[model samples]
Target: MLKPLPDTVKGPAMRLQHMVMTFRSALVDRLVAHDPALSRVRMGARVTLSILISIAALIAFHFLVTPLPSISYALAIVLSIEGGVAVRDRTPGEQLKTRLIGCAASLFCISLAALLEGYRLVADLAFLGVILAASLARVYGQRGFAVGMFAFISYFMGAYLKPTFAELPLAALGPLFAVTIGHLVRTFLFPEDWRRDLRAALKAMQGRVMDILVRLSVLSKEGRVTENDRTELRHMEEQLKDVVLMAEGLLPRQVDGTAHSDDDPVTALSMAIFDLHLSAESAIVQSLETPPPFVLVHAVISGDRDLAEKVAASTAVEKGGETARASAQALLWLQRSLQALGRAAGKEAGGLASIDDRVVDEPPTKPDFSWKNPLVRAAAQITIAAGIAMIFGLFLSRERWFWAVLTAFLTFNNTKSRGDAAIRAMQRSVGTALGIIIGLAAATLLAGHTVSTVILASACVFLAFYFLQVSYALLSFFVTIVLCLVYGLIGQLTLDVLLLRVEETMIGAVAGTFVAFVVFPASTRSNVDLALARWYDALGQLLDAARDGESRYRVIELSSRLDAAYRELTVAARPLGSAWSLVTRPGPIRQTLAMFLATSYWARIFAHDFAEAKKPLDPDVLTAIEEARAALSKAAARGSDCFATRKPRPVMAGNAAPAFRQGAAMGADRVANLLNRLYPA
Candidate 1:
């Protein structure tokens, strides 16, 4: 018989059990997040096209024609793809064009690197030139990025093998055949339309926004909201909106037989929805962060029918007291946002204007070419890394030298941040090791079975493309297996070759990491101040707009600011978090960002309160507002100085106005708290 448990023991044990259960549930939820755009059926279709031709050749030839040729072509077809680089993107035609172009360019570069291999001076210059070309190709967008990658890989292989003149033609034909087959298979056989995916993303975002709005409506009725009532639902809404914009950017740009007309209007509608959601979030946050009145909440609920009806209903509530007036203004602002969203989805979708078109002939204009551009600087840095790595590769491992240079070029990925380069190099090293081991195992097990080799290669290619965005380690694993099979079919698999390849890759990875960290380190920490400044400026602009009674432009500015500030902070934080040093981390920047976001929430409410005023504020309150604004600005400046200098400064918490502690006083206190937290001792 079990004895009765003590109350103290039971209570804590039950609480611990509940926590473990909750954590387990959350873990499962997170595991299934980010659903794959392609269904298993669709993936199987892609797999069939990728390998069916090779299998047919094997069956028809019956060993008459060697499996090596078809295998090489199959490898090319599998690797050369738009989907191989990015995901859920609907630009098959564009990818085909860029990949094919890259294929041709790579063939030329590979041949050139081979012929000039003996001449160190000439070959080095050629390598530099091709690398530069690859770097600049990114100006053309994703297609160019693919081209750069393919070209770099080709050059690496050519330089590594140092093939004879007789071997060049065969080398060129393999990729040409693969590219032809890949395009045919992708274009005619298993065509993917991204419009459906885009619609799903848009609907998902809209649904989330509607849910948040509904929740806020219910909460508003309670009329006594605490700080905990403010949820991260707004942050989630922003993330969803970001996903929609990112998906839109990946849509097909060219007008061809495959392009759909309906996508244009729908694309516009998505952008409008994203834009209006920004304002809606700001307004709703103001109303809910500090509850206004039940009348305003009712106005929002009542106006949910249509734009006109909502606006008219909000106007009816404006005639009450000052509290009711502020609530009415917020209701009108939110309702107008909802109306614009409806218009965007309905008849006026095309008329919902934006600064840029969804699809354009030319790439968006960026800053003119300068060394200041991270790409240009990276080109210079990579050139040096390659040149130095080549020397080590030639002297230490002449036959496998290309692997080192390839690693150096591949490591950077033409992306910003040294931290990213370091991380990528590490991933590649780990992935390649696992991939090579598994690939060799598969080849050995399936030896002498040509059809088996083809089947496994095809499956590996399928899985590689599917998991490309999901994990670099997984991609590297599959890619290595496919290449190992192709090479094994050519009868080139040997212990010596395997060991040499591994050694060269390791060398390259170390060299690449060294270059990223030491020689030309562009620490994101240096840019932390600039990112903070951008956030501050955006918040200041929103406050000014609200104070000036320009709600439309104010909301627009707020939306743009939300996008810009968040993007900058994200860009800065990723690298900072991954930084090599313990001191140089994102913790500080994230802390500052959190405090700013919190302080700004109250500031937005304060702005709306003043903006909705029909008459001038009392002199006493006006004075209080001015003092509070100064304190907030001063806090921002101090935070900037502390980050730049890495020294603690005195913290100031703006004093609350004795008379209006719940209004301006409450907001001012938050600003002061932010200042203290932003640069704590």
Candidate 2:
């Protein structure tokens, strides 16, 4: 008889179970945290397209070959191709690289699986399980690599398991047809012209500068831009970046042999956009100077010719007079370049005239590149995965081991923490178990009727399609259940056969998942900590630039800090179980660090606004600047301490200013809004 669980043992087991559950919940929360904007829509579309094509291809495969052994191989090829590259809004050529890398890595994984049959204790079933588990662990923290490896292993498993040569072809062909159809659908829906939107975005960036100039003029004259205006400008800048990335995604890669085709308008437009971007950089470098070229343009727009002329003649940026003439020349060249590009592309140009043409020699400072550490970890994970797969195949039956190995490889990505991997393992185990049970039940209920079997298959299709977008695990559940039942219907459906299939599936899934969790656990704490450290560094830079009156550096620094903080915060938020629990959860000090980083950025922006208010050297303005500087110093110190303590800190207040002078005050408020969202306290 089985002994009852001891209270002492049960308590720890239950806690383990609780921790696993909460961890899974956390990851799901983070995945949906970024308001699901374009990503959500794209994922939905992709899943729907994939499922639709998979169904149609399966039907064709059933009719085309009498005893298909080529099917699995074909499916593997298609899935591998699909997995190879993912094009984002930034770089289409990058997609080609991803595809090449993914394919090569997958092929290597498959070869390793084939070689694993030599290992002790890894013979037959266990070998496959170990191989798959190891491959999946490698991809736990990354995206495309895992998927590519999954397709490769899964295809090999299906191909090896076939008793008949005909069945082997059928398995490969089914998936291959599915992916080909999906690719065709995607090509038809998102055409190249979507890239034209990038050119429009570039034009809009110029317009934003002009718009900011107008606001600055009003604020300088009356003292401060409104909070709403600042927020809108920030939003516009974000949109501009998004659009640029999107266009870049649509452009053909040099590898595709279509990078700059004769008919491509995007290439020329992209070139022009890059030039204007340089101009924007130049304008930012001049932002610290009183009566800078942009300021002169603003003054002219406001009907202050005297102020404009006076400001135009002065030639210093950051250091004073030696660089003044160069800065003016740079501004003038920027104006001409903007007009030329705008006229060539039929796009509107703004803020270009304010740039001094001769200022081209001043190079902008570059931001730090600490974001690349995660990639090194990802590479190591993949190498380990290949080794594990080879060892497992050595111990298990080559055929059965393939199935187990493939299942393991799909379990996690390169960036996932060990806790996150544990959560995923549990989900995979449960989902697979349930699918097998349901598959057996469906086979029994619909016994021996062709129409009923077909109907059951169709129902499975609908459910898989419906839930695939919601969650991949759930999608896998239906896909597995339906596949088992349908395969049974075609192969001599019997109660014994159905039960055996279910049992085998559960055995494979569990073995695969367990190995993945145990082999090499991922750790989120370290990654989050690293991100927080970078954020602090960025925060320090922003504060230093503000103190030195380096407006361009401050703005550039602000963007980098925001992006890093958002990326890190997103990673932290996605893996937790409950939204409320994220704030209360212990061990993630990065969350607190992220909050303070945001606060520091806001305080610096406020100080910049206060400095801007002292135009033409009013003694009162310098006094105000000194006061804001002290406030900023305290805020930065508090931010640094909060990261060290992992404790929540109070947010600092904005600079004191009357309602009339609130024009530039709006810029400070916009930063404050972003900070509030980040820290909430």
Candidate 3:
């Protein structure tokens, strides 16, 4: 059993850890400092967009159909599916499946709604009923909600349109054809294949990392790796996280494309190379904080020829007690991976981009879900949503569909905070109002004529697609105008219709917001805390792995932990309160935590870098790292209170070599100086 540290030690340790986190957060903040222009450009202003060509085809449908009844029904189905898909970061297959589910469910629900019309009160309650059902459905996960949304939208629209059961077939077909065609286009004609494109990007990132590594080796040999190079390397290192995320996101779409086999010569070699690189990085960061062996540093500071012959070759070369033979074998593997990638790209182009070579048998875990009871909980949720919608429908306007829409939107994700939910609600309300205003204006201007309205509607559809990435608001604005204008052209723009839409939208938004706020709000703070815990856990794992020495599993596990921690940190930073503390409190707490976490990450890399430092000259570097860890541990125990006030104690020389001790001390001093400069008095 492990003994716990005393409060005095624990307090400082936590503080030191916190400080490290702060430093890393600050670095990230500098990199991604928010810009309104960038957000607008990135979001693509396309909120009003249906499944791109899905909406486009809908326009064509309006031109073909004389009455326009089927068009509205189809549009509603499109909207439901689009809304569901929008929330998820979907792979191509998933996206297609979601759309299909929405289409089918909507059709069935609407037909059922028509059948139930005889029960006038239940018929009037259709909209609100769906809302309740959808809200309850979402607790089951994205897939559940996806199916629910289709059913709810179809039922609500069919009931409101007062369509006969027979009309449901036509309503369904319109959306089905449009959606199927649109997905084919998205899958085939998009600028890149989702998985393939992402893999290509990952390969490019690997190349970049390799280039940085080569440069580092050369710089170490020449003693010329400057602060600028270090900074650039750090930036490049961060980008690897992005590439990994992209690869993960795309992998689900092209599972078959991932061809890396356990026995595949290239894959095994690539894995080894990755481990070595990480080891090198860990060593460098450790050296920055503690004195590393002179030989290890010397190998880096020496020229390329020396580095290639010494540190690089020694670290990467396989060990069978035959250094040259191992180095040759390792070199051959690296060459093969690079050559294979290049040849694959040249011959098959898109096929090379798909790198889902590794098979993962189990599906990834759902990120957030906490239920006291599973079946009971789900039933309770369904009861609440349906109950609320029924009460509203019965007591107020019988427009039950409003309840469903509200329930769907509010329950979209297990939110981290009420504030986030509030923000989304605000966006929805604003978007809806803006859309309504635009629609009304377009109707009034275009006048009540089918031919002219269809022409104008098509133009709006085109523009909406072009700008969907800009701003959801802008997209919604255009869509609202087009649809309303078309309704007006049909001579159906009575004050009643306009008033109903506004009322329904408002009702849905308000109800949804309330439900979201009332439901257990997931706080970003908790996630941050969890991430910090994981970071510490990762640090511990990395240390153990290093101590255990040369094992492929150990190395892979370390890298995986590092990747997971980085992702968690990134997520924490995105939400408020996670990283804003640094900005709000730029004192020692912030500064210290920032430095500590950054150092921790660097420390892990340094450990990796010293993989080849088993030679006699490597002892000095290893001693320095040990000394640095001790200092950090001491500082952490003190809660970062006197990081500036107190001086770090000198490392004790046990079996440490004299030259190594001297080099390690020098390295530690430089790092201390850097920390002092970064924090200031």
lDDT of 1 by residue, 254-291 (tens): 44312333335543454465445545655555555444
Of the pair 1 and 3, which is ahead by lDDT? 1
How much is the lDDT of residue 234 in candidate 1? 49
TM-score, one value per model: 0.64, 0.49, 0.57
Error (Å) of candidate 3 at residue 45 is 14
lDDT for model 3, on a 0 to 1 scale?
0.48
Best by TM-score: 1
Can you rank all candidates by TM-score, best first?
1, 3, 2
The number of clashing residue pairs in model 1 is 0
* TM-score of candidate 3 on Cα atoms, chains taken together: 0.57
lDDT by residue for model 3 (1-681), tens: 223434555577786776677677765444232221122222222222334455556667667864445545455435533542443424667777777776666666777677887887666556556655665566556666766766665665666566766666556655575456545544564423444454455455455546544644455445444677666666655555454444443433224433344444334433444543444344334322233223433333332344434543454333423433332333333333344444533533454334344433346555334464332343334435444544554454654344334443443334444434444445555665687777787677767456667767766665554455434456556666665776686677766766665555555555545654465434444544555556545655554455445454344446555556756654453444323222233243334444544444444334434332443335555455455545445433433233233223222111111222333233433333333333234
In candidate 2, what are the lDDT values of residues 1-681, reduced to their tens digit? 223444555577786776676677776544433211334434445544555456545656557745444434344433532432232223334444444454444444334444543543433344334344434433333334444444454435533542233343345354445445544544555322332443444455555545545544454455334656445544544444443344334333343232243233444454454444444434333332322445765654454556655665664343546345444434544454466556646531222222222111223333222335443343344334434544454354433444344444444442355444444545555666677678777877777776887667656654664454355567567766776676676675555544444444344445444444454434444444455556545654554554455543233434444445645555553554333222344343445534444454344444434433444434443343354445444444443233334334433222212222242344344343433333234
Error in Å for residue 367 of model 1: 8.9
